[model samples]
Target: MASGLDDVIAAETTLSDVDGANGILVIRGRSLDDLARTARYEDVLALLLGNFLGKETPLIQSELGVARAAVFTHLAAVDATILALTPIEALRALMARLADGEDKAVALQLIAAPAVFTAGLLRLRQGLQPVAPDAGLGHAADMLRMLTGETPNVAQVRALDTYLVTVSDHGLNASTFAARVVASTRAGLTSAVLAALGALKGPLHGGAPGPVLDMLDAIGEGDNAEAWLGAELAGGGRLMGFGHRIYRVRDPRADALKAALAELKLAGQTPGERLALAEATEVAALKLLRLKKPDRRLETNVEFYTALLLEALGLPREAFTCVFAAGRVGGWVAHAREQIDHGRLIRPQSRYIGPAAA
Candidate 1:
């Protein structure tokens, strides 16, 4: 048996493909580069949902807005104690309060919950009132507004949109697989989404970006990047964002997010000094990784630039994974629907090694 199901192909999917060997990602027959550069998050959502849900972008956006508002009503009922939990925990609690259903509208609600709940939970933790969703605003824009209680600028919105689209779907990742497993039981969309969120809260799955920022902050100045990274490597500490489990080459998502960061810089929005520090740190990390592990191809992955871009967008480091969930919930919902229709219950067998089963 493959440990960690390495090289195991559990199910067939048409939603998204992660060609790790080639360092490419494709969603619904379109290359990730094309989609990230051109498509909005709603457009990608429509693509992933396909006919299971309606394909109209505007309809999805409107429905998501309504879903967000509906989810907000539950905040009043949440225990203030839960708000003191980690952001992901708070989000999971709020999501569990959403009623389950097996319908397109419910799927939309599941997709909408992460964005609303995450923003709400973060605001609540900051001792601020939760901002309601604006049905008129697009998903990315409104998420920013909800988080900060101020209107987001155009560049901020675009950066977030690109992030959401880039991470929307990525093969059968751990969280998406969790979502599919829950879906296969016919537990309903809300349950599947909650399962996905639970899985994503783990550091191995969706928790690396926050550490990436921590690494940068510790490094401090651009001139200090190489020496700081060298010391970290010498101490046998693993670099946070310079490697991936799937991609042998540089992660395609990294390239996409770095390009988004570039756009933010060009628009005069991203902090120049911070951007320079991050870019210098990335270069140093890549160089040191190459020198130290000559046998392995360790390169920058999505988490590297994800931390930078989100930092540029003014999101808190603690809220990083929540935003990741917000982007990935669409993929989770679509995969759940696909598993329900075309996949099985995902029961795997294990060898009896404990005292020969007594």
Candidate 2:
């Protein structure tokens, strides 16, 4: 048996396609590059939730924006105190507090919780008051506004939106599966969201990007990247930003985010010398890995560019996974609502593994 049911296809879905072998990612029939470059978060949300709702609801966007703005009103008192908690904890509290009813209000709060929670958590951690959301702004744009207390330029907003949309939905990913499992029990939306957030906080999901930065830092200015990476690999430390479980080739989201980072001019990097050095390091790592492990197809994955893209957006590494939650809230809510519509309790059987027949 493959441990943990590894490589097993557990369920059929309409959510996403992860073609690691070909380095392609298709979400709900759309390429990630197409969405990241062109579609707004709202548009992508509409696409993801389209099948669940049975109709397009323009009001969802505005309603969610207003709700996000309104929730910040309550955080005024504990704004400073909450900062002491980790970002994930702060997000959990905010989501629970804002969850209240079955009307559109609940839905809106669910939609807005990620942005509100993430932005507020970051500012609170910085010993700064949380910035308010601008209801007139798009979801991604307003997120930046709340985070920095300044409206992002068109390019900046676009880049952030692309990042949000790129990670919005993937087929039965660990966290999404956890969310569905929780949702299947008919648990409240906030509960399911918190469960999903907890799943995301793990290194296998949310913690990968920070180590990518650490890898970059350890490499020290790209000059010693090759040698440093070689040493790390030789020492039995896995490279932080390469390879994927599902994608046999490259990760499509990696290239998409990389392009967005380039477009925003936010790589905060000198392209020629530094970029060339990074590229050389990447090439060397790949060559060495290939030569060293010919049986396994280890290659670059989404985490590499995810680290660089979020870094360019000025987000601290600690907040990366929370930001992922911000984009994914839509899909989670939609899936929750969808599961509730069907009303099935998730129950899977497992073979007895401990003290069998005792």
Best by lDDT: 1
**Residue 310 lDDT, candidate 2, scale 0-100:** 79
lDDT of 2 at 238: 93
Off by over 4 Å in 2: 51-58, 77-81, 100-104, 266-277
What would you estimate as the lDDT of candidate 2? 0.75
lDDT of 1 by residue, 258-321 (tens): 9999999999988889989988998898899989999998989999999999988888988899
Clash number for model 1? 0
Off by over 4 Å in 1: none
Q: Model 1: C-alpha RMSD to truth?
A: 1.2
- Which residue window of length 10 is worst by lDDT in model 1? 349-358
